[model samples]
Each structure stands twice: as C-alpha cells, then as structure tokens.
Target chain A: MTAVRVIAALALFIPHAALAGEPIGQIKTQTGTVFVERAGASKPVAIGDRVFESDTIVTTSGTVGITFTDNSMMSLGPMSRLKLDQFKFDATTHNGVFNSSLQKGTLSVKSGNIVRQTPEAMHIRTPAALLGVRGTEFVVRADDAS
Target chain B: MTRLRLIAPLASALALSACCGPKDLIVVLPGADGHVGGVIVETGGSKLVLDKAYAGARPGSGASEPVDVSAYEVERVFAKALAARPIPPKTYTLYFVSGGDEIVPESRAELDAMLAEIGDRKAVEVVVTGHTDTMGSSSDNDRLSLERARSVEAQLKDTLAAKGVQSDSVTAVGRGERELLVKTADQTADPRNRRVEITVR
Candidate 1:
C-alpha cells in the first residue's frame, strides 16, 4: 500500500489522541483508515482523509475529506484550517446532524440523505457567514477577502 | 452531583459558543409506504414511490437487510402499515405564503427533519437559498425572497440552539424567482415552486 493508505490505515483504531501539545479531534475516510491528533500536532492529512477539531492546520502533504456515517461529505481544500467540533449520527433512523467551524480556507460539501430527513441538523460556519444546508450541494470559502 | 459537575463545563462551553453562530435541531421524518413523509407536493396517495434499484444511504451498512424489490412490478413499495420498514429515497417541495417569507408551523416538522442530519456534525455547511413565485414585481420578488431566506435561517438557528447544535457554520441566500423549479408565468401560481432550497454540506 502507498504511504497515504498506510497513514489512513493507522488512523482508524488509534482512538482520539492529543500529543503533548495537540488539540482534540478525529478523522475518517471512505475505505481509508481513520487518524486523529490534537491541534498543532505535526500530523498531515491527504485526499480521502478528515480531521475534526479546532486549531489544526491542513498542510500540502495530503488532501483531506470527511464522510459522515449518514453520507454527508465535506472535502477540505489545501492549507485550510477547519474543525469538526461536533457530530452525532444515528443510521437506524437516518438521523445525522453536524456542526463545523472554518477558521480559514475553503471546503466543499455534498450533503447526504440526513439533511432531507432533518434539515435543522446541519450547519457550516465561516468568519463572515453561516450556512444551513437542507440536503443540497454547495461550497464555502473564507480567506483574506472572505 | 459529581457527574453533574463534570458535565457543567461542557454545558457552559456549549452555551457560550451559542452566540458565535446558530443553535438549531435537525430532525428526520420516517417514511410512509414507499415514500418518506414530509413532501411538499400533494400526493394522490400517502405512499411514496422509491426507485428501489437506485435508493441508497450512507453510513451505508445498516440498509443491507433483505427485501424483495422485484417481487412486484413496482421496483420498491413499502407500506405505512410496516412502520419499522426502512425508509426509501423521496423528495419534498415546500411552499410559502404570498408576500410573506415566514414558514408556517405546518412546515416546521419537515424542517425539523432536515436539521436532524447536519446538526450532529462537529462542523457542517448549510446553504439555504430562497426563492419566490413569479406573481409579483421583480423588486417585490427580490425582497420576498430575501425575507423568506432570512426566515428560514432564523428558524434553523433557533432550532439548532434548542437541540444543542451550535451556530458559527451556517449561511443563507435569497435567489428570488431567478431559479424556479417550475415557471409560474406560463403556468398557474404553483406554491410548490416558491420557497427555499437547503443544502446541508
């Protein structure tokens, strides 16, 4: 397997861990393993990877994306500072809600069936705006011009 | 009391974050027959039609139960009689009042269902774009569309707050009648086409 796949593999079972000075967070991907480190940790995320929490930065080593158990997908752009502060999804009833904060950069989302099932459960935050999705696809950006 | 004390810090943190963004609840509605409930279009029957072959949901493993989709001519048909049967894919088109952007109480149930999905995520993007029917002047439609979008945005914020979904990651837009699902100028005043489109990202 490639290095990225190897990292993805190690990510899943490691549990939410914060290094000596890292922040708290988790990352999951499609067919890829899950990995997490606290904010400021030197860990890198690539395509098909995700990170959930505050104070983390996305470096160029890997492109990261997040897929909630309910099918909602968010792909973070390169060099972005995004955190998944909260997520609760119950597949039994098709109920999954999420809240995310974007301190900097861009992220694209293709929401899943949960929004159709429950619109109020989804929200996206940026410096200048707050976006509420009801099961449609869109992108949000925050940068110098934001 | 010790347990409560441990949880107090989390609760206080959540409360403090409430002002940074929106706090709303996202709810999911069950399906009746083949169709999931809460659709805006008036249906001939309460049962919804799901293209069984194409219907799919994620965190995908739970839907692997055995159900004969081809037993009948209809690819997929579930009955309201079996409340526990899995829900199928369906669509809903909400309508708004004339010259008003407020979503009626009746619509709250459906909105609640949508919010249930995204509110759980630590971070999500909800793109709520508003629309208006082609009955009024362009300016009026513009204002109406904005009002409608704002109304939905406010409702989402309030609902999320109640459900423990903090704000800070939500936005709303007013598209007016620029993008109508159905053109009313050529057809009747179809309430179905005049409303907002919420895309949870």
Candidate 2:
C-alpha cells in the first residue's frame, strides 16, 4: 500500500505460488476462512501448515497466527492480507532476515532472534509506511484494501 | 462516578480515531515484561521513530512526532489481531551426572511442561542437543553425550506420539566437550556444563 515499496514486495510474493521456497515459519493458529496463495494457487490454511517465502496470506473474515523459525511471531486480523516476501536464518549464528508486507487490515508482531541478533534484519511494509523493527512488539493497521 | 461519566465522551472520540481515522497507523507496544523498544517508520522522504509503549504514528501523513495512545484505544481497535498472536518459542535445559549418562533426577521433567503446551499448537518441533563436561576422552564424551541425548529423545518421541501431538520432527545431537556452557580447563568436571538443551517451537 505504501505504493512503490509495498507493491514491489507484493509482486515478489504473488504469482509465484508454485515457486515454493523452504518453510520459513509455521501457522500456529487459524480461525475461519484463512487462505494461503502460492504459485498462483490458493488453499485453505491449517494450524500446522508451513509458510514459505513468496506466500501470500489472505484472511477473509478470519485470523491467523504464525511463528517463524527464529521465534518471531505475527498475527493477522480479519479481512487482512500479508505476504512473506523473504526469510533466511542461520541457526548456528542466530542471524537472519525477515520481510513482510501488509496490504490491508491489522497485524501484530513480536520480534525474535532474527531481529535481536541483527536489529535491522526484520521489516514490515504497509501502504504508506515501511517499518524497521528494533526487537519489540508492535501493531499496524492499513485501511487501503487493494 | 459522576466524574467518570463526564470523561466517557472523550474516550469515545479517541477510540473512533484509533479505529477509523488513519490510512495507516503504526503503534509500538511494550513487551510482556513491559519493555518498549522502537520502530522506525519511513515514508517517501520522512521518517518517524516510535519508541514508547502505546506511541502511535501515521505514515501517510509523514509525521515524525508520535501521538500518545491509551491502552484502552489500542485494545478497542486491535483486539482481534492481538488475540491471535502465537506463543513464543522456548528452551529447556536438562542436566546430567558429570561422569555417566544418567540424568540428574531433578531435571528429568523438562518435557512435561512442554507436553502440556503442545496441545495448544498444531505440532511441536524439538531439537535436543547434548553436551558434556571435560573430564573424559573426546570419543567417550561424544558417546556419553549422544547416549544422554538418546535417552531424552526416547522419552519424548514415544510420549508425544502416544499423546497424539503430531510431531515427527524430534531429533537429538551430541556436542561432546566442544560446546561447554561454562568454559574451564581441560579435564575439569563441571556439573553446569554437563547438560542437554531442549528447544521447542
């Protein structure tokens, strides 16, 4: 939604539903009609479903909670859309990157090892904002429904 | 009671703005321990730093200044999303006898708490890493550590399966004397260093 950056991030996460990357996280909770779109195909999500890079999460009057490999957590609210643009972690060193974009609705995040090991490693994008996390819990709401 | 009633309208206005006013609103929240960090919000050419608990900003307006938000406003606006947060990952340590693979009786129950937590999530992924004190030969320590790890793994693998926790991701590894929790001279025995760590996600 922040136009350039968000659009760019979404572009990377969409269409490639078939280009499934390795599991970067897992769905810890799912309620109602949450769907995951991968490589241009959409499927309903389950509690233990693995989330990968380039995957788009769509919540149609539903909610979802995900925990990343580095222990980062994110929750999406009803009528929300989010994309896992990319994620990489080196368990040995606890260094990693996490990038995601929120197109609409609400998201709550708790930063974990990736951000704690490398403070600039995690970022969340929105229609009008690009957020750089510094090891904290935060929330964001986007009204533009694209 | 009368004064509280008088302040109700102002609270309503805050809730309204919090729910429907900004095109994009970012709020920094305190951690479970009440520690607030910071978030840098970047717009076209401006940036705002929200560094306080309940501090809010609107990126659409390119506002560098943070607006103080009440906890009530945040709860009213973001109750659903906040409620959906996943539990944090956790690590548990099980100590071992310095000379043998026998686990100290007290730390054998590290997995019991984890077992109760597994039901809340779809599955549990476990990594059990074994370590040893430096009092033995490298190969012996390696074997001892691995045996220690296997014993713990045996306790978990079947118990979790019997409980229908749906986890085939349980694994064990031995670090021998390579990764000591407390660094010490060679051939020294330290109870603290002789341990196994279980991580659950």
Best by DockQ: 2
Q: What local lDDT score does residue B143 receive in model 1, on the 0 to 100 scale? A: 80
Candidate 1: regions farther than 4 A off: A1-63, A66-146, B1-93, B100-102, B137-140, B186-188
**Model 2 interface DockQ:** 0.42
Best candidate per lDDT, number? Answer: 2
In candidate 1, what are the lDDT values of residues A23-105, reduced to their tens digit? Answer: 12223322222223454455544332334434344433233555554556565544455667666654334466677776655
Worst 10 residues of 1 chain B by lDDT: B78-87
Instruction: State the C-alpha lDDT per candidate.
Output: 0.49, 0.82
Candidate 1 has a TM-score of 0.35
What lDDT tens digits, residue by residue, belong to model 1 across residues B1-201? Answer: 999999999998998666443211111222223333321111122222222332221111222322222323121221111121112222223555565656667777767666676544434445566777677676777787767777877866876666654464455566666667875673346677787877554
**Each candidate's TM vs. the true structure?**
0.35, 0.77
True contact recovery of candidate 2: 0.74
